[model samples]
Target: MSGTGEPLFVADGERDRIEVLHVEDDPAFATVARRFLERCDPSLEVTSETDPREALDRLEEESFDCVLCDYDMPGMNGIELLESLRESYPELPFILFTGKGSEEVASDAFSAGATDYFGKSSDASEYEVLAERIATVVEKYRTERQLERSEERYRRLVETAPVAIAVHRGDEIAFANRAAADFLGVDAPAELIGDDPLSYLDTDDRAVARERIARLLADEATMESLEERYVDADGNLKHGLVAGSAVEYGGERAVQVIVRDITEHRERQQELERYRQLVEAMGDGVYALDADGCFEMFNERMVELSGYSREELQGRYAGDVMTEAGLETVEAAIQSLLDGETDSVTVEVQAKRADGEVVPRELTLTLQPTEPGESFAGTVGVVHDITDRVKRERELEAQNERLEAFAEIVSHDLRNPLTVVEGHVELARELAEEGASGEELVPQLEAIADATDRMLSMTGDLLTLSRQGDTVGERHPVALAPLARDVWSTLDTGAATLETRDPGQVEADRTRLEQLLANLLENAVEHGSTDGQSSPDDPVETPADGADEGLTVTVVGTADGFAVTDDGPGVPQEDRDDVFERGYSTEQGTGVGLAIVRTVAEAHGWTVTVGESAAGGARFEFHTDG
Candidate 1:
């Protein structure tokens, strides 16, 4: 095929279809150029043009693998044609084929965007050089095009990535995406070009960030992910997590950062940590157990209480950590929670601590499942040391036993003597009256009888006071108005009037409540009535203390509890606190009346405060722990 007598062997890969155009002033030379290329590869499809102008025009309408144009053509020379065609197709393969072979023409053609040049000869062998030039230029063009396409795709991928992405090389910033611009508090990434990324870090954190980057670049450390504070647009610090890896960017190796905003997540983590610290620092033991009764989490207080480290308690069974008695009660409570029988449970256990000190503890367990269904997630336990409570209870039992013994003595031993004394005084009075000789001794006999009766009454009152220490557990709804009226009927109110109001219904001891009311009413009549009538003891002239009667006592209901007040002489503020003492008494009053009222209220879990009444007298209000 060529004068050199060399044969062409195509490679074992798929051959590219080569399309080319040839131009010359003579039609014969155009035909020759086509033959030279076809001889190089049979896959070549070469179109020939005799007119230089027509060849340039045809290029606009069709694509070609390579363009071959002759020098010294009519309208355009080889170099001129190369320059003209390159205006539209700069990368189109163009080879100058010319009979005029000179360094001047070759230099001119190459400078005018010619891909290669050929010295046209009369010998057909010279055509081989032209064929080689066309193939080489086309192959080079194809390689460059593929590289451009690959680079384009990579750019688009980074641009549309979800996280904020940036490319930085040392202190120079190369490129950044839209998210990166927003994250960096800039209008565009172009503004960040050639700037250090550490500018976004706080002053104190910048050095740390720089160290991390240095380590990553040196391959000494992998900064795959790190959380750092970044200053926002307003110069306020925010949290961001930087992730991703080193990559080649902008013709140099750079670190490609994918920044994620973690401000909210970090805040939540901080709050959870604060709550954990608070729980750990508490005096009570706090813990959580999974459905299988294995410890899920336990605060520091729990570790201290159990004498175990945080590591020792991990995944350990709660029952296994507890003493036998404690474990039994705790497990029962947890079982009740799991069975959906109770929302919470409290049990007293004489548990042994790590130091081998056995003491009573109150274990309160609450279920915390995600749903209301029977599926058990876990339980939260709050433990309190009830050792002091148990000690006080034991002491109270002993005191009650002694008081019961004292009450028996007062009821039996003291009452029998007072009964005999009263009988003798009555017999003496009868003798004075019947014999008619000791008329002068009758008053003395009557006075002695009165003293014995008063002694017996005081003995009975003391016995009642000693016995009311037990809680008022036996209670029924008792209408207080009817009870007040009934108690008033028994009271000897000489010139005092009783007023009853609807005190609602209080759950109280029927007998004890009536006794409490009786004491309160009797006290009102004794030392009451600022507008004083005659004292039962004095029989002296005193003004009436009420709008109608000597004194008025009111028993009425309040929101939480009830009150017994009187339009009578109120206790002074200074004496109010001492009035609850057992031996406390006022002028014209028995020493034991109000003290008895306090004892009954305390037994019923009620509190009383002394205040001035609306009528300028005593207002003893009973407030229940509602």
Candidate 2:
């Protein structure tokens, strides 16, 4: 194209420089030819080589854009040099400029890989043809190299892409990348060649996939991303978002499909939906606020907890629900999160109900994550009504204080009087032994000593009952049968038999449960007598008409919990309701034991009740389901 003498229009400045190598046998001829070529095209820089051998050496040393050589040479002709140059510099432009003008030589120049041939004579215009040929060939070569580089970069991009990409040609896959092969459960991309892409889609999605593929292949329009179900080679169903567009592949129109595996994303979306439903139905209040602390979104539970309608709470500030102090605490926590000081925080606050009641609440606030340099966005909050919890904590504190006072009384007032009584009784016994007057007082002194001992025992019982048991922390699986037998062996029962039936394991505090069993068994041994006798070793000589035949205590597991029963005169129906009260006893026994049993049961969140057993005895049933 440049040989027609039109401008080549190369870039301005130094980029227009083109180097040319000229080989001729004669020094004068080579010199004149180089000057003529340079004068014709100011952009060309021509170097002369007298011998073809020297020209080959120069080519190996330096680079040139085009080569100009003559036909006749000492070692090698122009065509022969070109043949050798083609081995290493195959694409370098070579032009034959020789005085021997023959069809035979022209044909030989081209067949030997010369780019262009021109016959040279005494004509100065022939040099213009040589310059034109050099410019045209060099421009074409550079452009073709640039295009190859661009194609190489595009190939790398497609091969290394993150998402699955496949090109389909007439219902069969022509190309697939590694991501596509992995998504389709194939070992390599080559394995997917000539496979129908539609075969990977699930039955319900095949028709939609076909329609979208048809639209793209027909050059109608591109299809937007659509979620569809597909099956892998392992027959496991998965979710993908597919988008398709028409593309040229191997000189034919084809569909290039991009599939992004959305299975995990879809599952996460579904899980969030389920959590959203749960938040709406939960008893605690869940709400979101903007950076200014104005309500943006809230669950139904928030409305109920705040005693405000959706219309009333929407767009309202946090001050509508929390007091000023609580709002300040929440704001401070949010600032801490925004400052990267903490992840989340829980603070106690007072919430004002719509009914004008201010109740204690525990608010847990967490700031939503944002970009590193972004300001605080908002906060998600969960509010728990802690009114009942606060009240219970105060009651437990008072109960502990009362127990401390009772312990002080037992240790000082009651013990001092008992010690004095024992000292007097010993002195009276010593006086009787010394044959002093008033020796008859010895028997009365012994009786007083027995009463003093009984008082001491009752004092110890009071201390035992005062203990409400430590906080029942972390319940564990405890077997009941072994615990019952172990406690029964430590008791002072002589004839009272113990039995455990179907006493399975339960989740309970082991130490507290053992204490409960000990107290209950002791109560049974003390009252399980038909003749209303205190000692289990002493038999009832003349049994009452409708009394129990013998004392027997049994512990058995129930569906909801467990039961402890004894074959004795059952507690009266009138006294059943008050039996668990402290210091309430029917016989000559401290009621503190049963009261301890009730305290332990309550600590474990179990309800204890007194009823008549099947064998006409008092049954204490502990239900844990509440």
Candidate 3:
């Protein structure tokens, strides 16, 4: 369809479309060239431009598959135009067509980025060769453009990711995309592009990181992970988890490092460690198990209570060392916990020790969820050796039965005789009144009344002691602050002052917590004050050291639970274990107060311990589930 003498046009019907631009001064040659291209492929869209300047304008206006230009023209020579077109669209295939083809001119065209050079020859099929060469160059250019776009998209994705991503070449940081640059506190990746990664690490960690990277590159490991310390832009040391993997970069082998900040996680782990230590130091046993009911961890007290060595019990199944019935009970308790039936479960069972001895233990299991959407993995159990407690309870029960029999005998059999004696005394007093001796008999009657009152008080105390273990109170979250205030307000000793600090909450029995607080407050007021006065000039000084004003009560929350501190004389180290025993008071009052506190706390499955307070006095900490 091109005019006569115009370059031959090719139509590639198999392709979606084909466009060709032909520039020639002779209309006759363009006509012949276009016919030859159309015969090669019937769908060719060939446009002929006789004016060289017009051809350049057309090329600027539209995209063409290939351009065929003649060597000689009126205003612009073909070689000059070809040089200009290559500057703008270097990848567009250009073929020089000329009537006079010299080898020197052809070499010049090829040097100017021409695809190929050809001459109008006598041979009939020369135009066909030119058309075939144009098809090859155009297809190659399109493929190259697609590859460029794909690489561009991939580069953009890596630059915008949230996690730090870096590329390394040998030991140098070759590229650290945007996220990694910001994490390392650098202006751009270029700043660190050529720097060795060791420069960013601590002196001691540099060799370690380098070795890890080397091992990764050698294929000895798929990935290497370590905790690395680095000085940030602010010159402060920061902790991060460094993970490295092998990669090929820029035609050379390298390793990629991913740094993640773990400062908060590390701090939390340290806090848990401190809590574990505190629990291990206590008299009660503590055990932490994993999801499969295997012992993941346990404190020394737990090992001692179960009579098992720590090495022997760790990683063992709980059911293995327990009696068959005990194992069944524990499994049911664990199943209930997993099914969300209860937050905790308590059961008394006998456990076989490492030496094959069986001990009675009261195990209280509390479930803690480590992550959301995960099954109840394990329980933290507090086990107490209650064999001795049970023995003492039985002894006290027998004593109570004997006392009850004696009371019944005295009231029914002895009281009648005593009443007759009192009546005879009263008649004697009346007769004496007539004889003027009633005043002397009045004193004797008053003594008998005093003795009876003392007996009644003793009976009341005995009854309270007997009923202590029989009562099982419901447990709940009890806030310590308001409870302490109530206890302080109820004490009628005007000379003694009460001061309480802010206290958090703990899961415990409200009545028992109040009772515990009252006992401790009364103890502090009685022992830390002189002549019932809490003033500075009192004979008994504050137990706290210099700059401390006076005895004060403070309740504080801890990782395990809550603790009550008092700025009063602390219990002697030797007496710490004995202070919880019944009738062991150092003061004049009966010693059942602290004993009651212990009994109530133990009933709720909590551990009570004595330690030094921050205020330089006794601290009683109760570990209740919070």
Candidate 4:
């Protein structure tokens, strides 16, 4: 098979042995043929057989590289003997040596699988040519036999490989092994023998996969190993890690594909994604650094906390966006983790925002170690923004001090004066009732009572605002339909029917959700209706010019969350953001209503924006986490 250094035929001067079985019934012709073959090649090994039956028996018992037979025998002719020899030993070269030189006989000899046909001749040169032809036939048969064995061995190995193995010629799969057939969900390799491999991929991926394969074949280079998905015969999907290399098979250039199943690996990857989502859903910021102390990955909260885009954080050093002091502290902590002195460390540090503001963050750093070592592979950090929390703590401490001071002032100064004033007023009223002129005393006493009531109301509102800031109540999915009904029922607008649209559910605190609905309903009732004039008793009658028509508040659910639209005068675009600010009121409002709306919305991680409504009025669109 591998004709590396083998000679074509034996040289003339060498002691070559060519076994020739001369089957001739006549003694005279047999002697003549023997002498002629010896003259042609002096090293010829000629053996004459008079009986055709004996020669046929010898072929079965012994092996010869070449056989010579004669035609027109009594028992068995040359053609019949050649057919028998071919069936038993097809690779052994056979030459027909007969006295008959008819064209019909030569054609019949070849048809019976004879390597060559030679007849009796007196010329020595013609006999030499016959001998040379026989030598060439023997060498050719030997090479062909070796090639057959090599091909058989290769076929056995390819068919029994564990992984899918396929040979692709250009775009078609020329040959696919048994494993390839099973991987493709086919019964046998023959089913995919001539099919295009790219047909197994999805339509979108077929063109790209084909281009990659073509490029690999064109350059005669191996394709890099990659994880890819393919559709099987049953229309089910299969994931695999595939590697391809260019090779020569069956005298043609082709590519070989080796594929390993990786479905379990892909499933594990999906599970990791689910865990990552659970972590990102938390309020606190979380991030991971690589072994080189670079920001490799982070959650959405981390991006919001730092006020930096994910693209900007990736590949950047961890200390690049931190304050100078914070950077030094973080670096030292990381070094400690890398040095194996700590498994995890927590510290308070300031993170510098994109706008150059330094926000205090409580950072908890844990060393994520590599396998079988104390050395750190990276660090996982959970950062909590404590700016508002710290501010609230200080404010609570200050409020406690103020409350104590207020109590002291009221006990010693205000309460004592109030008691004296109350006694004086009572005495003056009694004297006035007894007919003493005391108009000024009566007016002063009423003024004191009004001032005291006003003070109490102011204290109650302040306390309510403080409590709202301190408590983050239980949050759940609040159905907007019932909440809107409750707020609408409390409205005091006479003769006005509140039209409520289908507002879907939102995740929010129960009380805060109720408060938000209450504020919007009250605003629609108070400002949406006319200032003073009353409407007619009949619902069909319209009010006067100064009186307002009944307002329609439409609440619609959106993909993001919900929207509330009022058919009232819309706010100008320039004042939309300012309207949400504390103490910003256009209609002499206490200005705490919209501010409370904003605070509650923000507390529940929702966004509220003002825009023009479909009714050509102010629309407030709010979104909650769905």
- lDDT string for model 2 (593-621, tens) is 67778877888889999998998888989
Residue 614 in candidate 4, Cα distance off native in Å? 64
Candidate 2 weakest ten by summed lDDT: 1-10
Question: For model 3, how does the per-residue alpha-carbon lDDT over 112-220 read when each residue is reduced to its tens digit?
Answer: 9888888878676875776677677667765676576668886676778665677785578887877677667888777778887777675664565666677888883
Clashing residue pairs in candidate 1, if any? 531-545
lDDT of 2: 0.79
lDDT per residue (tens digit) for residues 90-198 in model 1: 8777888777889998898888888888877887776676666677887888778667767888768678865688888768788888887777788987987888888
Q: What is the per-residue lDDT of model 4 for residues 400-468, given as tens digits with 9 covering 90 to 100?
A: 754664455345434534675677678777877888776747765765674464345334434555567
Error of 1 at 599 (Å): 27
Where in model 2 is the C-alpha error above 4 Å? 1-359, 362-392, 395-470, 530-549
Off by over 4 Å in 3: 1-165, 169-171, 177-179, 186-191, 202-226, 234-236, 243-248, 253-260, 324-342, 345-347, 370-372, 404-626
lDDT of each: 0.73, 0.79, 0.70, 0.72
TM-score against native, each model:
0.36, 0.37, 0.36, 0.34
| Positional deviation of residue 617's Cα in model 4 after best superposition, in angstroms | 58
**Regions of candidate 4 where Cα sits further than 4 Å from its true position:** 1-238, 243-245, 249-251, 258-261, 325-347, 407-626
CA error at residue 78 for candidate 2, angstroms: 99
Give the best candidate by lDDT.
2
Task: Score residue 600 of candidate 2 by CA lDDT.
Answer: 79
